[model samples]
Target: MSQFALLGKRRFAPFFLTQALGAFNDNAFRYALIGMATFRLGMSSQALSTYNNIALALFIAPFFLFSASAGQLAERMEKARLIRIVKAMEVAVMALASVAFMLASPGMLLAVLFLMGLQSTLFGPIKYSILPQTLHPSELVGGNGLVETGTSLSILLGSVAGNALMAVPHLGPQLASAAVIGVALAGYLASRAIPPSPATAPDLRFEWNPFVETWRVLGFTTRNRTVFNAILGISWFWFYGATLTVQLPLYTRNYLGGDASVLTLALALFSIGIGVGSLLCERLSGGKVEPGLVPLGAAGMTVFGIDLYFVRPHEALLREQNWWSMLSGAGGWHIAIDLVLIGMVSGFYIVPLFALVQERAERSQLSRIIAGTNIINSLFMVLAAAFGIVLLGVGLSVPQLFLTVAVMNAAVAVYIFTLVPEFPLRFFGWLLVNTLYRIRREGIDRIPEHGPALLVCNHVAFTDPLIVMACVRRPVRFVMYYRIYRLPLLRPLFRMAGAIPIAGAKEDPELLQQAYDAIDAALEAGEVVCLYPEGGLTADGEIAPFKPGISRVLERRPVPVVPMALRGLWGSVFSRRDNFLRRARLPRRFRARIELVVGAPVAPEGVDAAALEARVRELRGAEA
Candidate 1:
């Protein structure tokens, strides 16, 4: 089903609306306060600046103080009930904000900002952790995409509404106040329609101390190295985004020489770009949590961000032009496109990391992990603010800052990819398979979701491992020939994937024993191990005899063996059809159609190498 189908379902729509409205209300109230401080409060420029900064700090303080406890609450309490409580609290907070608006008291409005932040902090853990329970594994990426798109749109609309409504002559504040209250109440109503989502850790003890719990939650996030690095990647994205967004107004005024409408134009383009990119993720990922897009996003961010620095408008055009005038200017479209693409790639970068964390983290500790992520994200954002300040203080132009950030982004991506090689490995495999073949899989669901299993497949070409990796949802460790495993270009990827490399016992008995030991250990730890039972790629367009080594491995592990076949790959360039070098000179077989067919698994007790080979050959009937 299309991911949009989710928008119509009771399982998703209500929660989505509730969350979007909450975002709308938050931004509306925030911009309303800023509008008051800027134009209505009659304060000095320096005082207004200080007040704005203080307001931001007050808002972020709650995330640092309460996110850990909030995570624990979500895990321990029923999620739907908790969401309703949160919505109710938002209504109360907005009601107070309305009073602050009426009284025109800066102190009261600032307090409301802090309260709204606290409310968001409380909702953060529940917001993310509930999705995995409510949606199917297949819908996780799509669901996240929709949520992100909705939130971005809400923020855009809310900011516009808040500023526009507050500019109304005499009753602007009253209307703005009423708008936020109404939205908050509507959010509460939407929350009422949310179906029940039970707590993941209902029996767990609650940790009330925010400091201790914060440390404990962060420790849980680090328990898995990949999960930890994914969280870091998420945090870095927030940092990058915060830096760019905070500079937009300055960038518009100084570099683009545009007015207020132009700033709004830039913001709108970015928000819409993010919405477009986020919605596209479901289709691009084939309804799975595909981290392969993350590298693409990072690379795009750097490329376009650097390009943005060079796309600056001439200073002569800096004279009081409106958004339309700016658009008609020479360099205007370039700047707008750069901003939009940056936001779009940001969507690609973040959604998968979120899904990866949800899929990989311990289910019972998922809420806490999300809370930890929030804490780290907040920290990064705070650091981004400081970094921007230091750069500006050093007399760096906003465009120069953009260039510096792009460089920093590249460095950070490299560091994170090194820490967690799975991301890059998956990207390489995804890129190679998708670029070279139109892959179709049949009966892939027969592969067990968990526990040990031996995957026996026909080795049709040198790229078989990558093709299988791209098609399967679960990670598979391949048992490959030592020569292929050690191929200079593929060695790092193979090692990262934990592929076992084996040689003939007579040639290297120690290495062969180590390969068998690694395979046994991987299977015993409940991982899938794939073996090309044909032993090597076909020199002819035919299945080779099955190697008895598979039977020997099963004798020790006694795991069920799934038989699979690759069709239409025997004649590919990767196969030794004529000769490796000779085939390379032939026309590239780009996007060639191929299929992977899986047969029902055989029990360990009844499995035979020849029988398995026959089953695979049957699956690959015409191709073999």
Candidate 2:
């Protein structure tokens, strides 16, 4: 089913609405203040700028102060009730906002903004933590995509509405105030319908000192090196996004010579691109959390961002252009497409990382992890603002600054990928499968999404493990024959993947023992391991007799064993069909149609070598 189908489900829709509305109100209120200060009060430009800076600082302060406490609150209570309470706080803040708008009290509005930020800080942890509870393992990427799409659009619409509404005459403030307050109430009503999400860490102690708890939660988030690195990636994205987006107004006005309507068009295109890209993730990943998309996305962001600088009009146009005027001009369309593609790739960049955090973080401390993420995000935003100031203050043009950040994105991607080699390795596998084969999966969901399980498959080609790893979503440690594992081209990838190389007792007794030890250790650590019990690839296009090595591994660790088969690969170039002299021939089955059929997991006790072999044969029958 499509991720859009989730919008109709009671389990997700209400919370989706509540979160989107909260986002809408927050942006609407903040932008309404900017509009009011800019147009209504007739303040000096310097004074308006100072007020804007103060407002931004006030809103961000709560995240630094209360995120850890908020995380604790989210963990200590049921998510539905906590969300409702946070919504109630928003309503109160909006009520104060209504009075402040009527009285035109800058101090009152600033205080209300601070309160809004506090509410958001409290809601932050629950926002993501509730997702894993409400969504199926297969639906995580789709769910996250939908939420991101809604948020990006909401923020865009809310800003437009707030600015338009507040820029009017005497009754403008009244309309903006009423609009935001109503949205808050509606958000509260929506929160009431959210299904209960039980607290993940109800029994855990929560520290009262914000600083100490902040340190502890951050520690928890970093314990898993991959998850922490993913968080860092996420934070960097915020920095990249904030830096790029904050420049849009100046970029549109000074460089493109566009009016407000044109800026709106630019924003719309970018946001819509994000929505499209976010929705596309489920289809691209086959309902799995595919981190491989990260490198692809990071590449697109840099490529398009750099292209944006080159395509921009060299000399700024003196007169402002409207939407139609720009579209009629050559320069306008290129810039628009660049923004949209950049936005789309950004969606590609973030959804997987968010899904990864949800998938990998310990269930009990998920809320704390989310809180840690929010803290880091806020910090990055602050840094991004400073980054922009430093660059622009140095007399660089907006496009030049954009060029710098785009190149920096590549550097950052390299650093992160170096830290987590799985990213690039998985990217290669995912890229290969998508580009080289039309793959159809059957019963692939039968394998568990989490916990320890042993997978046994017919070894078809050298790429068997890579194909399976790409499809299974979670990382799988493959056990391969020592010879194949030692192959020059494949060895580095295998070692990075933590694949275990095994040999028959006669071939190498010590190596065989070592492989068994590694397999047992992985199972005990709750990781998935795949074994090709055939010992080696078939010399002919047929299944090899199952070895008894699997039985010994089962005897030691006794985990659920899933039987799977690879079909339509026997005649491919990667198979024995290519003799050594003919190996350089063009792929016999280039872009071959392939299928992976998975059977229900077998309980270890009843699983002997022969029975599992029969299951795999049955799955592969009449196909390979």
> What does candidate 2's lDDT look like per residue over 530-618, in tens digits?
99988888788799899888999999999999999999988764777776345667667878898999999899996789998899999
- Residues 310-401, model 1: lDDT tens digits: 88723434555788888888888888899899989989998889998988788899999999999998888778777877786677777888
Which one is best on TM-score?
Answer: 1
* Global lDDT of each candidate: 0.85, 0.86
Please provide TM-scores, in order, for all candidate models, with all chains considered together.
0.94, 0.93
Q: Model 2 segments beyond 4 Å from truth?
A: 36-55, 99-110, 313-315, 578-584
Looking at model 2, how many pairs of residues clash?
Answer: 0
lDDT score for residue 22 of model 2: 95
